[model samples]
Target: MSTSTAPARRSTALPASPIRLTVGGILRSEWIKLRSLRSTVWAYAVVFALQVAIGLLVVSVTVSNTGETFRGGPGANIPELATLGATAGVIFGQLVVSVLGVLVISGEYSTGQIRSSFAAVPKRLPVLWAKLAVFGVTTFVVSLVSILIAFFVTYPILSNANITADLWDPNVFLKLVGAAGYLALSGMLALGIGAILRSTAGGIAAALGLLLVVPIVFGLIPADWSATISDWLPGNAGTAIYQSSRIFEWWQGLLIMLGWIAVAIAAAATLMRRRDA
Candidate 1:
């Protein structure tokens, strides 16, 4: 005798997203995630404190020294040097910022939180965009505030050395703002690298290499091509944006940096769409 077997029951599949996506919703989610992280809090606090402290120190030295004393020479006073000192900490603080950017995403991948994130928002690209928006805007605002404080506070001290600049001047204000922009874009670039590599170490190394190591290696390579290409790199081009002297024009530097950010992020989106969580 054959026994009839009842049909096995199956659970119904849910829609990819239960909640509707609005700009506000995505932004709120990203903001919550970003603020919840202790590392993000610490890194940003350190960045502001470290960069401002360096600016103060630089200007203090400016008040104390004669022409080119710090650079080890007797020469005419270089006005540009003062502004350079005002923003000098950025060159160093950027390293910390870049590491944080990499960790922002790679930490998720490592901890397997990314899968949960994808499970929540199956469309994926919105999450990436939201992350970029939240991080980029936050970084830009903080950086702008920090750099401006550095500029204003240091200006008076540097004035004692006859190194002064008016913020109204196109070159000066632009660079001051551009310094913040550079930091924001640099962070995004690191984020893109982090997305692509999906590893904290690899992402940080790639970002730092682009920001720090490539220039050094290229600088050491005894070839004009190396020098030319190096000058166009994100680090070098970006530096020109905020420097007292222009290497590439401000527009040129800005355009070059935007190009780098776009390419990296685009490549990341491509991989992210195809890859498994």
Candidate 2:
């Protein structure tokens, strides 16, 4: 009996076949989880609708009172203005996306669903990478569609106001795409923060504080110091990607933004490895 029990224990201790954690499988799992959440669909829908409606309203008002519009700035840079029209709502929409991203990770923790995930994958980082990949791709595609629709809706209204713009203009297109990418990246960053913190409130606070509040608090400092540090803030750098005439060069701004994301993800990974969950 002792000998038979020993062999059974040894067999149980041996590892089973490993799953290689392929990207395709991970992506499929992420998509299913993402779509199943009712809040995600509603939040994104509201964001897109708000962006389009506000754009049309702005354009209509500008067309109706061309005199009032000129006070904001010159309208001749049609491309830049048009990009702003399409994405002005991103300033707030990103917060919605960020919260959604946070829940993508935190909700699992909240519900103890992550234990099942880990049991299935065993390799934790693969799950993280898969989630990031899925979130980035889905967010980018959705944002692209939202911006394009906003552009088309606004263009006609602006035209009615006697403003002409080319949607295909390089700068215009860059701004549109950049805005979409920015939203995607912001969501991923928030997800990483959530993974690190493992609490919805904590993650949201940290993400929002870094992206929004810190920039403002730092901005109050004297210009020279503020100018140097402010450029590196997550929101400032990420949003700079959309600026046709950026405060920092595009590459520099992008690097600063990516740096923030890298640090957050690294911290999250470290916690994941060290913690019980």
User: TM-score per candidate, in order?
Assistant: 0.86, 0.88
Tens-digit lDDT track for model 2 on 1-277? Answer: 3545334565558797576667688779888998899988987897798778877776666556766464334536766666667887788878888888898999999999999988877878888988889888888888889988999977766655555567777878888888888888899999999999899889889888887889888888878888778877778878778775457776666777788889889999888877887
lDDT of 1 by residue, 1-277 (tens): 6896856544334545566767789789889998899999998887788778999987786557655454422473343555665577788777877888888889989999999888888988888899888998988888888887888888777666666667777667777778888888889889999999999999999999999889999999999999899999998888777774346877788889889989999999999999989
Candidate number of the best TM-score? 2
Clash totals, every prediction: 0, 1
Instruction: Note the residue pairs that clash in candidate 2.
Output: 63-161
Candidate 1 yields a Cα-based lDDT of 0.82
What lDDT would candidate 2 get against the real structure?
0.81
- What's the true lDDT of residue 222 in model 1? 94
The CA lDDT at 162 in model 2 is: 51
Query: Candidate 2: which stretches are off by over 4 Å?
Result: 4-21, 63-75
